[model samples]
Target: MRPSRGLLLFLLANLLLIGLLLHSVFTLLTLLFEDCSNDAIPAIDIPAPDALEEINKLPQYIPKIIHQTWANESIPEKWQKAQKSCRDLHEDYEYMLWTNEKARNFIAKEYDWFLETYDNYPYPIMRADAIRYFILNHYGGIYIDLDDGCERRLDPLLSYHAWLRKTTPSGISNDAMGSVPNHPFFKSVLDSLQKYNRNWQIPYVTVMYNTGPLFLSVIWKEYLPTVKSEETRVRILMPAEYNDHPWSFFGVYKGSSWHRNDAKTIFWMGQHWLLVTVVVFAFCASLYVCGFYAYRRVHLRDSNYSAHASPFSSWSWPWSKNGYKPIKHEV
Candidate 1:
């Protein structure tokens, strides 16, 4: 019967533990809710290299603009080719480079409300990430990272009102996004930026969650639930459509230039995530078992004491008021 009480207490404690875990998962796991990869959204289908004429026939919804950002006009020698690649291909497209000065002034001018928060970001990458969304939302066009080069014409991508490339596992990325000016999704992104802006302490996490792809992805995931029709839906570019294949819209080059030392740890975890998840759950389960049994043992021991009187409590000592006196013949 005493053991039964321990088991009951164990279950009750576990119920609270389970609730907390579920709550954590619901909150931090928002990014996993949507897998925009594959057939989850309208496909950005492009014609083959030989079918150039057909690609031109596609309607252009986004404007003829390509936006990139950096600290200044001096593009790095390593990425110069990539930068030139997009330019050489899209000669007809107007290009705008938002250097640090231009970006800050633009924010101060157009989005004065966000000026304080924008300037207060702990990392330059945060500002870089934030400005791309603002610029895309305001100017309306394709926002490509300087490291990403154009593989072919981007005419097909403009057909969608808004679009993002699907990252691994879940959610969309901010790199190489396309949108018409004032798309609802980017509005969600711009509006949510101020709220998501917080110092995560670690350089990488701060940049990612505050203004990087992870931030954009989370916003897109949260914003997707309210979609009513295709017009407002944000299209996704799958791997094949993005850069994996030869004809993919863009080519990936050396990037993540802002990565700090912690980035290696993060990347390692990502590379071995399944093992990490299993080990974490295993440790938690082991801890739960140990705690449950430890509690049960202590509870049962206390219960046993309650069931009977203590030997010391029953003893009678002659010198104490509670003790019985020796009998006359007791010698």
Candidate 2:
């Protein structure tokens, strides 16, 4: 039976309202639990307390080591030489292995020059994204940044983490992070990186570079207001031991050979790339929505707008004599 004009209008209004309610509900659901999974988190045994204590006392000083594999292959050797210099100051630590496949790709993509020009580097080229995965799957170990080298022993951090714990009054620090052989938190971090790696390539690598370094900034400035508090096993070290960004190292002078202008530029570019990408995506989405509304107002109000016109005919308002009536149907 043909519906009356008033009833048709009411039905359309109700449909719009229902659509909006459903959209909001789905959005909230995604935000609340999209990334959540019930998969089992592998158990990891914490280092033995007594053994960790002994390891802590063995030596506070550790030689700074950088690992890199490049197209040139000479970087591994140069890395060895740099390691020697670090050894002169303290006991030599072996160069960190890159377990992350993306970390290798990152080295190749970001620091192509370093690998090609600089010979004798210590580590092989690996994607930073895959670093944790490789470590978790192949061997249980920790990867430290060469720039953030510490003379102090890490046993305290190792010992303190029976399980992942809170880093701040609220948040967790990704810098100086570690995983037990099969800890759930460790697995989670790897899973997150795996998901991250699949979507973005270069952008994610840049994040891996200073995941912890930037966390240092938050300790001092409190940039990000607060993260959702529901999560667990996120840990942060005391600010003193784990120095973060904007904290100048005393006695360290300018042009310390360690500082490179080019590295700084590259870092900033990565940050800009992410920012621009996000902005562009948002802008495009807004345009699409606005254009859809405009099209609804124009064609839907005209008699030319017909239910059989096109799939886009939803905007057509049949009740109005002038055809171009605003949709008060508030979804």
Candidate 3:
């Protein structure tokens, strides 16, 4: 039996109503999450002041020795070179903090802003997920990146009240960062990351939230007092390479080192091996190409024998050795 026109019309009206209701619900949901995304700071369980103090005593902080890999690099030769570089940096800094339980917990609690997963692979985003622990766990000072080997003493950075360097056109590089316990910058930075993360779904706010130095500068400007003498020593380093030079941790792409992996681990291990491997491979290939060209040139030039020489003249060539020497016997 066919349904009545009224029944069909009623069903259509209900469907339209349902659609409208769902749209309204979705709009409300988006609005609700908007605040969370825009907010810069995430709620964290702060460690007691005494516990934080205890953590500060664990070891002397080294500006180098950011992090290490338990497994060798994918390429052995490259791994060795990177390890040597890390070691050299370690010598300069005296010590790199080892991965320990306290450190892990601190990172999990403090910097677990992103809620990203390593999925069994080490990455910077994972570190971003737990940056707080890294800062709190290590003593003396935090080492920022592994690949960035220090060429000069960071005494200038340490000699000031607080120091931050700007990179390229971007301001305030986070590649090498340092802070004492409970530094306001730390709180402000974390807060900014959390706020941006919270409002991440809002397109405009998401962009703002994901930005590192923007967040940093904003926080520093808002909170930290600027004094002429030793209060804030922020400087931007002129970039040697204009291409792919990132000024802040926020400049990293979604899957890029800053965005995807932890700051400390990526700085320490991810980059050196890749750069070394590429350099070594290029060097080896260049040698082979040059050697092959030289060998071909020498071999061809030394091939003084002419294969197409006439039979009558084969024996009479003046430069001919035994193989092609002209026969003195008259035929």
Candidate 3: residue 205 Cα off by (Å): 9.4
Model 1 / residue 232 / CA error / Å: 0.8
Worst 10 residues of 2 by lDDT: 247-256
How many residue pairs clash in each candidate at the backbone level? 0, 37, 32
Error of 2 at 262 (Å): 13
Quality of model 3 by C-alpha lDDT = 0.40
lDDT per residue for candidate 2 within 1-331, as digits (tens), equals 3433544565576568657865744432232222211211221222232455545554222123323222342334324443334334334434544433445554466445433321221222223323433343233434443333444334434432212212332233332444445544444443343232222234323343322232222221221133233132333333333443232111111222233345565557545755755786587667656755564556445534343433333333466565443343333
- In the range 120-169, model 3's lDDT, one tens digit per residue, is 21433333433432462333354444334333233333322334444422
Error in Å for residue 113 of model 2: 32
Q: What is the Cα-based lDDT of residue 146 in candidate 3?
A: 36
Top TM-score hit: 1
Superposed Cα deviation of residue 268, candidate 1 (Å): 1.7
Off by over 4 Å in 2: 1-126, 136-138, 162-175, 191-194, 199-234, 244-289, 304-331
Which has the higher TM-score value, candidate number 1 or candidate number 2? 1
Q: 1 or 3: which has the higher TM-score?
A: 1
Per-residue lDDT, model 3, residue 268, is: 48
Top candidate by lDDT? 1
